[model samples]
Target chain A: MNGDDRWDDDARAAYQLPIEGEEQARDRAILRLRRESAKRRTGMGAWWVDPDGLRMRPALAAVCVLAVLVIGAWSGAGWMASRGVRAPRPSIATLPSGSTAVTFVFRAPGATRVSLVGDFNGWDPEATPLARATTGEIWIAQVPLEHGLHAYAFVIDGRDWAPDPSAPLAPVATFGRRNSLLVVGEDQAL
Target chain B: MRRLLALALASSLLAPGRASGDESEEARLRARLKPELATPVIEVVRSAAAQGLPTAPLVARALEGASRQAGDEAILEAVRGYAAGLAAARRALGSTARAAELDAGAGALMAGVPEDSLASLKRARPSGSLVIPLVVLSDFVARGVPVANASNAVLAATRAGAADPALLRMRERIDERILRGEAPTGASREGLRELLMKTPGTPKERGSREPRERRQP
Candidate 1:
């Protein structure tokens, strides 16, 4: 038999045997109870009254709180970073000095009506429709330009965007189709 | 409801400003078309010829076309005036005419002098043929001349041809203002025409004055 097996058997036998010395057994039980009670009291004292124990406990608590705060801040920053960049708001465009007039010309063979919209005229689509020229092209009603650069575009037949062919081209497109930028000088170039 | 009310109020306020802008533009156009301001194409062409310049007949053709298109007598006259002046200046210098000379001629024509009179004045004094004198006159009239000229140097071009029929219309208007005794110093022939246009169908007494701008050399 293995040593552990023999030892287990012996323990079982010993447990099963009745105590021949009742006075000795009673003394051992009382001693065991007193030792257990002393240990519990010492544990409670360490929690409530021991200075070193209190200091160590508070330090551990602080470490845990700091870890939680760091995690929360990092998570919040990550969320903000993932949101991407916001677009710029459009400003009401004003003409610079010397600009007096602007002419818009659109070449759309299929279009029946063409209208211009921009920060000027409050983006009103129905305001002024372009008249058809002899070549089936569309031209604007004589628009008096303000001084400065203006961004505008043509809306053809209420659906499509058509840029002006005759006007100077603009590369910037922060809004819709590339806008027509017109620079009105201080003096009219008639 | 509140937003709609705010929008309505805002639009109502904006409407007056827009209307004012339109009225001003119309007024400016009306001023441009006054009958007394009109200068004939033939006088302009003949004036340039006198200056040893040649102008194509294309300008005349354009004037005639514009006249036909414009039923308003005043507008027709102004377009014809501009065309005539351009032709006369072009004839004087041909394609080789300097930009400064062209500008001066245009400014004078805009001021309402007959082209023939302008040519005769230029011939009367050798100084008038030069660009500097015409530029100065343009400046005195508050018009831009592409060339450089000191304030003292420019002189008026000549006027001698069939008396401008348009001048008679302008004369009545000028006499009205003169009777009322408005300051006559800065008044232009074109300005007088504009006044007459405003008082259309109102016959007034006629009077004449010496040409306000004469070459002094």
Candidate 2:
């Protein structure tokens, strides 16, 4: 805009590159461009190496992206290799030593389905399905009951309830149904 | 808003014959309560049951209320509050979460753990049942462990493929350390960090150090 301002701007630009200073880089780029221009009369100078030409080559950009992909892939492979995934075991429920092995038995004459529902399985109806005897009217499942008081009952035909006949006398109001009470770790577990 | 949306979703998704089963359950529940206390408590259970919220905690609330000799209105309000809490817990823990997980997770929420942190813990252990972890986590916080620190400890153990037994062991160790006069925050922070780092593939978890992660302070 003004002569003094132009001079100040140029001076400021001189110190843009602190290590080598902008002036030195500018001088080197100009020298290289002039040498190339002199060697060939008109159009021999390449775009990448000229004083005001493109600062980075398309090749460099490709290389950078490739390097990033390579590093990312390498790390991802290592992560996959290190992750240990084990299948959920169907039996031998393990939690604490004090936990008791409780055998839940129920008799349903015409029922096609029976599951042992309780506090131990988060009351998940599907988590602990009972195994029915081939020729009998009984269903049974042995589950590891955690150490503490648990309320449970048998769910029959999905929505129907059939209380365990052998459950203790104490009946509790649970899920609007009577749940059998069993305290694990009593008598040091069974 | 969340409650209304959930209720609408659940009601719309219900099978035609569901109400009969629900009606019987409700009737049985009412039969169990005193006449003066039956209406409100049953209403709360019906609302929660309609939304597919776990209904056991509601009944347990009534039983607890009766044990405490609380007013009928108080029992209803308590059931309603717990139902809402369970809904929030299920939302955070995901739809596939088991009833026990929801029960324990609700306890965690009541103990002051944030819903998003519970979500993170669930996401971290995509396969394990989080019920025991959540129960132990809530217990730790109740016993004076800072909420964040307790959450972090649970998350770490779950990520390490620790199950109910391992979690119980970790809880015992942490509680013992706390009883020895060490601060809960410090004990959980360092103890969980070390345990997680030793978990085969989880060594990389040591460095994230996200300030928002449920941990000390």
Candidate 3:
């Protein structure tokens, strides 16, 4: 009932980490470490690692399911990666200068990798990779652009510089391949 | 062995050029076409040649129609119209223009681009092949941009010395606008404003002011 010092410094320190509270805290800490170690040794998080829990038929079924899941995830990732990303702005926004955005699409169904390389991105294939659309054969990417003309081409499977079929030709044949033109923010009458 | 290998390589390289054989393109068109379509398609081809216009395009147009299994009457009309447009293009582009330019110009004409605008584009460049400009112009019209705006916008750029690359860039930007569901006219206007900023003396009217011709932005 002596409220002035609230329980004594020794009692307050008792609840603190144990260098101050010693034997009891030390014993509890050892018990927690042992429990964690035993749990990890049993691999309870992965039931298959515990042999008694595994039955022959269920084990085979689980393995098959795991394989299916992995293959499905891999294929699904390949499909999603192929679709790249298209910014869905249903309206043309008057964005600030240096804030224009455009999407590029290339329809190469069999290609494993597609990248956008252009003057804007220093013609680096690694700079902009396209992802495949899950439902379609097209590969696509949306890139922000500054207001000006930029020339580009799609590198299919890291080679085969293919110009966009819907884009205008840059007409300059760099390395015997024509580049495509992307005019970001301006319009020419024609 | 080396001589034999070199001769084989030479012949293989030459193979595609001779794929059509020694016959004229129209003759090939006739051979490949149905009986009803052959005569009129040939007439269009021959008439285009008589006018000093490229006949291959007309033949190709007919053959393309045939390949698509179009009706004979429709094929004939398309061939005739394509040939007439080629003639118009040749007239506007002058006798020195190339076959590719003529073909693309015809496409522009078919897409409702005015003949005089083609001529104006020719006058703007006045020296190089106009194939790309014509193609881009056709593309603009195909994308549903108003013909006059397309013509003027392209002409404005061409007048400012925009080449194939610049023209294509302009087109891609406008196309992005169209893809955003902007009306072709609105798309053209917004895109033109962007282009005008790059071109010197393009009357940029902010707020409610109307765009005055040839004024500095």
Candidates 2 and 3: which is better by DockQ? 3
Ranking of models by lDDT:
3, 2, 1
lDDT of 1 by residue, B97-175 (tens): 5544554465455544445544544554433232433432433333221111111112211222212223323333433
Best-fitting candidate, measured by TM-score?
A: 3
* Candidate 3: Cα lDDT at A163: 70
**In model 3 chain A, which range of ten residues has the least summed lDDT?**
A83-92
What TM-score do all the candidates reach, one by one? 0.23, 0.48, 0.51
Going through the candidates in order, state the TM-score of chain A alone for each one: 0.42, 0.46, 0.49
**Model 3: runs farther than 4 Å from truth?**
A1-190, B1-22, B199-217
Fnat by candidate, in order = 0.00, 0.00, 0.02
Compute DockQ for each candidate against the true complex: 0.00, 0.01, 0.04
lDDT of 2 by residue, A74-184 (tens): 787445323211111333345667565666656677789888766566455677998886635667688876655455667787777544543321222323444544444
Report residue A118 deviation for candidate 1 (angstroms): 2.3
TM-score-wise, the better of 1 and 3 is 3
Give every collision pair in model 2. A95-B165, A122-B100
Task: For candidate 1, give the lDDT.
Answer: 0.44
Instruction: Please give the ranking of all candidate structures by DockQ, highest first, separated by commas.
Output: 3, 2, 1
